[model samples]
Target chain A: MVMHYPNGQPYRTKQLSLKKSPYPTATLYGNRGMTLEEEINESNQYYLKQGIAVIHKKPIPIQIVNVDYPKRSAAVIKEAYFKQPSTTDYNGVYKGHYLDFEAKETKNLTAFPLANFHAHQIEHMKACQKQGGICFTILRFTSLKEVFLMPASLLFQYWDNQQANNGRKSIPYEIIKKQCAHITYQLQPKIPYLTYVDKLLEQIL
Target chain B: MVMHYPNGQPYRTKQLSLKKSPYPTATLYGNRGMTLEEEINESNQYYLKQGIAVIHKKPIPIQIVNVDYPKRSAAVIKEAYFKQPSTTDYNGVYKGHYLDFEAKETKNLTAFPLANFHAHQIEHMKACQKQGGICFTILRFTSLKEVFLMPASLLFQYWDNQQANNGRKSIPYEIIKKQCAHITYQLQPKIPYLTYVDKLLEQIL
Candidate 1:
């Protein structure tokens, strides 16, 4: 059954559920359409085609509430909601190293709010790190058109401080600029973050 | 709206859609209740808690059709269908090495059919292998209650030969037993395949 709104828009339209991402709303980061995640996705495909790396964004987990099975056609999920993932958005292998990271964009001028990440994500990164995976966060300051890769170890210090009620709720951009590598956007593999990965490989190896 | 059967069973029940997996029907392999996938999930959870590995089965991606908003509680996914994934079911880091594999079961006593896998999954495994990740498939023979971890390299050889129309469509049990490590079942981890992983690591490192 089709549901029509007072404005004549159908409730069953595709646009409704596509907007639901688990991240806290950052209305200040006004994306005209494409998100940082989209760019990384495109970049990952490029990397794949060039045989540079094999990273991928895992699909968002959903809790399905209802589905309808028709005789001939595919099954239809009629009711579902997104679930919080236990790990980060992207992970893969780079030069025999296990790579994992999360990407988030903000319009904040002075700081990248640590609130953008969840506790479970922190735990997951720590777990991966313990297993020898390189884990980090990719922070995009949209308004500034700047991206930075901050190691999970550094992020944890601040997160731990926040939990102890002894520090700022976010990491100031100045520290990020000082400590993290600035990721410049490229045309083919737009997020060429692996250039930073090359440097990371150098440090570890 | 509520739906009811002639016997008065409610349509909003969870039993309907939970049965859907993209694999071709293998009704001949009767499952008492818990499946091989569920067992691996349990084992993965056990590994995670013990800090032994950081592996996880990727969520089944769904192409949603319709959703309903009830004004209270979570959003309801009204219609959705399972989508084919390009990669294997599970991937993660194990002691600094990237791990990727798929789990499959068949009742066939003589052989494990290659038809159980898709071309895209093969492509994905090859791509991951190129990036220095370890790739393999976990095969279970239901009637024999036996499981084996066959490296993707071996699987690829058979797949390539089959595509060239020069090999058996399925891998014979003798070959699997001779070539792959047997996965022993245990109580705590249930499918303690990581024991096979430990052996593989010994061979490599």
Candidate 2:
């Protein structure tokens, strides 16, 4: 979902856009622009265009309360609210594999916070994984400009331990760097995440 | 994406609802109450609850133009427009099968019109099919209240032949009745189309 601005930057987090803000707050991804979602989406476009993969980011579900339909015109949504999605943000077929994952960006440098995810997303991913789908999470360290694709199973262990009252609220960045595969940012594809998926395929075969 | 109205009807195609219409015209599925999208969504819910399958309709993508943010409250979308979806609506893991399909309804008794589909959707199903995804289209005759799941390959043949002047613009009702497996609607699942998929899997094995 690339919303191109005059600045030539992809608008992924357009809600926080200063151009649309009458009540301005601190920015999220607007400072440098080109969010992880934007990059990954671009990469997905490249993957699809080249017949490499067919991944897509699931759109956020919304409840429409009011609509205005003009005669001989496209309908306009007047009132709506975002609803909590039951599944992860991204999913599609990748080389005969059903690939599913969620991408999250955290400003925290020390660790990736678990609070970024919802319980349903975890459950959905787990279900997909159980049914032979390849599941993972793309974690983007915005401040660090580092991205990693972490296995869903590892994230689940940390999530399950949360109920014990002794579990860490976040996974250490060091652990992520050690465990997950680093994706090299490419010029054309932007975020070359599928190379890591190729490695997963190798492991599976 | 169940948009439940007080009528106990699932709110599929609710965004295009014409209640606020200054110019009142004929309605789509909203008139009769539950849409084919609704029945399929209801069936999907049943499937998820029973651990039979984990299918979900993809959210309709929207481009938000203006939002109002009151202090200390969730933001409200004031203006937005629906974006044309790039792929099929429903997809998920079904008995380890990567299932992907689109659902449509036409009141025309004699035939199901080919104009109901778009070029991009055909390309998407083809790509998914090439990758061994179980691709199909759920066709519902609203007047008859009958449903059939037609394989993408069969649909593709009709779609490709449409370029030729001699090709038919719509598939005859009799052809669908003879070629596709009929879905017997039941109380629990409402639209139990997956039973036909089970038969397809048997053919595969």
Candidate 3:
């Protein structure tokens, strides 16, 4: 059976349903259920307030073709078109190390889909890694209520193998659990992903 | 006399008109007249291709209230409202330095207006500077056709002064020219602002 989103979009689901009554939603509507994007954004805010790390989500670029000057102070965008982003979603500095990452959520229970990532994002991550920055992807299995922070090195390895006609389209959940750190959620911080980041840094050190 | 933009927006001209249209009027909208944001974005692309930097403009967060899912692939944002950004516009890593800055353009001729910047942006820049990261502003005087790279330290000095009833709303053009390096436009690289960044680094070194 296919699980349908509140917006009526069909999604892949596991045998165990994680669906629960959605109450106390965000100010944003379709965001009735907390999205991985919102959770991470909130987590970044938490990090910033504590002076731990400074990361921010890049804005989606839109070409404002036409604008209406309704008043001198307020310029309303009348006609605009979205542009494809050329970089990862989140980036900043943490403990003198430049950090860059993209966060994605998939409903698939067995593996994370390759299609969830774009060609440019992989290329951008490769470029960041070359520059000696810590680059990674935070993958979330929404159906399983699990999140994993996978390094870009492993991601690039899998991505290159896929190009070589390898059968792996998605990373298996078991492999992720073994290779990546799982993050827990908190109240004010929401997604306490950075706690895992500290652990990852300790391992690297 | 007030100078009007090609799009009919009134601007305060800093100097007398030097030359009339030598080229045909049709060339005005061609490759020569890209917006400051577009130029910077293109320059970032150039930096990425060269494996030099990985800067990206932060997306303006929007509170998406409603969306129309006509197809499974296409989710159209129907009802949404803009949210205030919490950090600087542009951020990334360049030569092991964490770079963060905001690009702003104004029509004011006498000085760069302080009101163009927000409170959170100032606070964010201060935080980045405290961490020994490179933080600055790329200020473009559209009416004067001039751009300058002002360091966050100098910016914060003026920003703080404004709070103490300094009575200065804009930074004088002479001070900017004396203290900050000017950026020239180029074809493929667009803004070529990072050349000024090299000079800034030289001063620090």
Instruction: Encode model 2's per-residue lDDT on B44-93: one tens digit a residue.
Output: 99998887888999987777766665665555777777667789989998
Give me the runs in candidate 1 sitting further than 4 Å from their true place.
Answer: A1-34, B1-34, B68-70
lDDT of 1 by residue, A1-205 (tens): 6564332223443464346645444311222213687788889899988998889888657765545556556656665665667888899988888999998887789998887887888999999999999998888887898989888877998999999976889999999999889998888888889999888767766
* Model 3 agreement with the true structure over B126-152: per-residue lDDT tens digits: 877766678898888889999888988
Ranking by TM-score: 2, 1, 3
Q: What is the C-alpha lDDT of each candidate?
A: 0.77, 0.77, 0.69
- Residue A38, model 1: lDDT of 76
Q: Between the candidate structures 1 and 2, which one is better when assessed by TM-score? A: 2
lDDT of 1 by residue, B24-84 (tens): 4431121221268778888999999999999998876666555555544554566566677
Q: Best TM-score goes to which candidate? A: 2
DockQ of 1: 0.43
Q: Give native contacts recovered, as a fraction, per prediction.
A: 0.58, 0.40, 0.20
Residue B31 miss distance in model 3 (angstroms): 18
Which of the numbered candidates is closest to the native, going by highest DockQ? 1
Q: Which 10-residue window of candidate 2 chain B scores lowest in summed lDDT?
A: B24-33
iRMSD per prediction, in order: 7.3, 6.1, 10.5
In candidate 3, which residue pairs get closer than 3 Å at backbone N, Cα or C atoms, i.e. clash?
A58-B59, A59-B58, A59-B59
